[model samples]
Target: MRIGMMVDSYKPYISGITNYVEINKQFLEKAGHDVFVFTFGDLDYKDDETNVIRSPGLPLADSGFYLSMRYSRQAKKILQTMDIVHVHHPFLSGRLALRYCRPAGIPIVFTNHSRYDLYAQAYLPMMPEEVTLGMLQAYMPPFCKAMDLVIAPSAGMGRVLRELKVENEIEIIPNGVDLASFQNASPTPREKYGYKSDDILIVYAGRIALEKNIPFLINAFTGIAGAVPNAKLLIIGGGVQQYEEEIRDYVAGKDGAKRIRMTGRIPYDELPAHLSMCDIFATASVTEVHPLSVIEAMGAGLPVMGIESVGVGDTVQDGVTGYLATNDAPSFTAKLTRLCLDSELRKRMGRAAREASKVYSIERATQRMLEQYERLLREPGRRKDKLYFRLREILQRSLR
Candidate 1:
């Protein structure tokens, strides 16, 4: 089948969505399916991967996002030819699929990968929460209903959609991680980064933005510092310039600031080695829609320490893979401190985490996604999507 991935941005902008699309495309191609990526702007940017169809759009600062209402003629032509299109971002890419692909009788599948409600609270603090939620309630349901199928990366995310009044059926599918790279990864020498073998390293690998709650993790580490002198927090990944600077300044002035090291934006492939070098993976963010980083960390054989919510709560089988604490510094720190102090417990949990992570491997996820795609294609008339198009056509004809 010819598959097209629609996103707001691509390459040079490393995001979970970008990684997911790239990996899924590679695997699909290997399985003898034609895969292509349709994105906006970044036309001048050279992509290392082939079959990336770029549409011209205005760049939205250094956030690595593009804003545009339409695709280039060439991109539209290519997109219309796809057997099916999977949309990652709902606002831009999702609407575009409805505009361009729907008329062509192409099935559009959308994946709800972001917690837009929490995102609005993080990015647009001035906007009232009720207003943001109301906007989502109005937008998401209709958008999801218009699609042939909607996918939620986790059950919690599925529940969120239902809360938004999205009556459309949501398929629960976990995000896939390339586990082969991490399965037997040799740990990076700790001395290279000025750490000893006995030093307890807790890693958090993802964007250091407002939604990620990086300061919370930093502050929680401070509470554990007095008890575990060798405990170190290694934060990997960079974010928006202003936010990154704010996190850096805050960490710099802390009492035990030296204990936390922020490695700004490492390469995607290098993450496995970094995970191997760490004893535990930690994240304070409660805004995840099935965090791929957490799964990747588990694949690298590190126990996770995360808040008991949505993606993190579902991924970590508390007491088995790692401990899930409430979203508070005291509770999170207490659990983190225990993992740091007890090496035996960490090893046992780490082993279990590795085994549990296999369920989210790229091969498994891709197969499930493929099955969904094939099933959607085999459905007669794709009634939900066709009904939408037929109504649209009727309305257009009536106006004429």
Candidate 2:
């Protein structure tokens, strides 16, 4: 099967969506399928992976996203040849899939991987909530209805779609994790990070942004730091320059500044080992669809403490895998205090977390995804090539 993964952007710029496309492509190709990534911008970026097709687009500031109304002529030509196309973003890539592939009867699948509503609230704060929500309500239902298959990475996100009035059937599939790496990882020595062997390390790993609720997380830690003498907070990952700077200044102004450490962005290959060095993984972000960082932290055998909202609420097993408290700092701090005090509890929950993370392994996730693809293809009503305009039939093509 030739599968096309359509996205608005791809690396040289790193993001959860880019990582998802890259990992899934490898798994599908390994399973004897030809997988191609169809994306915009980064046209001159050299990729170590094969079959990534890029079309030119106007770069949108430094957000790592590109704006384009349509795929390049060559991209459209190759995209229609796909047996099935999976779209990761709903706006740009989603519309293009319908325009280029729908006419050819190539089934298109869409996965909702972002908390776009919250993102709008974060980035476009000047806009009224009613208007943004109204826009979503008007656009989502029709666009989702147009797809052959629609996926939601978490049940919470599925509920969000329903709230947007999208009545289409939604499938829940987690983005897979490379579990073996974290499951068997060796910790980067604690001393190297200026921590004693017995010190308890709390971690928050993901882009530092307003939507992540970083200020509340920092304040929560500050409130409890005095109580937990041996505990330290480690923040990993980088994000919007302005927001990150704000986070730095906020942290600096807080008490017990030395207890908190921020290591901008680290190499992906080094993530597992670094994560393994921590005692707990914590996040305050409510804008996650399904957090790959949370799952990766689970793979490293760490208990988690997160807010009781959407994606984080769905992933953590509450008191069993870790605690889930209300979104406020006081509530979050009370739970963080408990985790810091109970070493035995952390160890027990960490075991359960590791076991729970197995289902999201790349191997199992790929197989589940492949099953969905195969089932869609086998449907008697599916149109594989009946409406397709074969490249061979278009002799006058630019042949670029």
Candidate 2 lDDT (Cα, 0 to 1): 0.89
> In terms of lDDT, which candidate is strongest?
1
- Count clashing residue pairs in model 2: 0
> Considering summed lDDT, which 10 consecutive residues are worst modelled in model 1?
381-390
CA lDDT, every model vs. true structure: 0.91, 0.89
Candidate 1 has what TM-score?
0.95
Model 2 misplaced stretches (Cα beyond 4 Å): 381-388, 395-400
Model 1 misses residue 157 by how many Å? 0.5
Per-residue lDDT over 1-400 for candidate 1, one digit per residue giving the tens place of the 0 to 100 score: 8899999988878888999999999999999999999998777888888899998888787888889999998898788778899999999999999999888688999999999999999989999999999999999999999998999999999999998999998899998988999987888889879999889999999987889998999999999999999899899999878889999999999999888898899888888999999999999999998999999999999999999988888899999999999988899999999999999999999999999999999999999999999998889876556457657767886999
Best by TM-score: 2
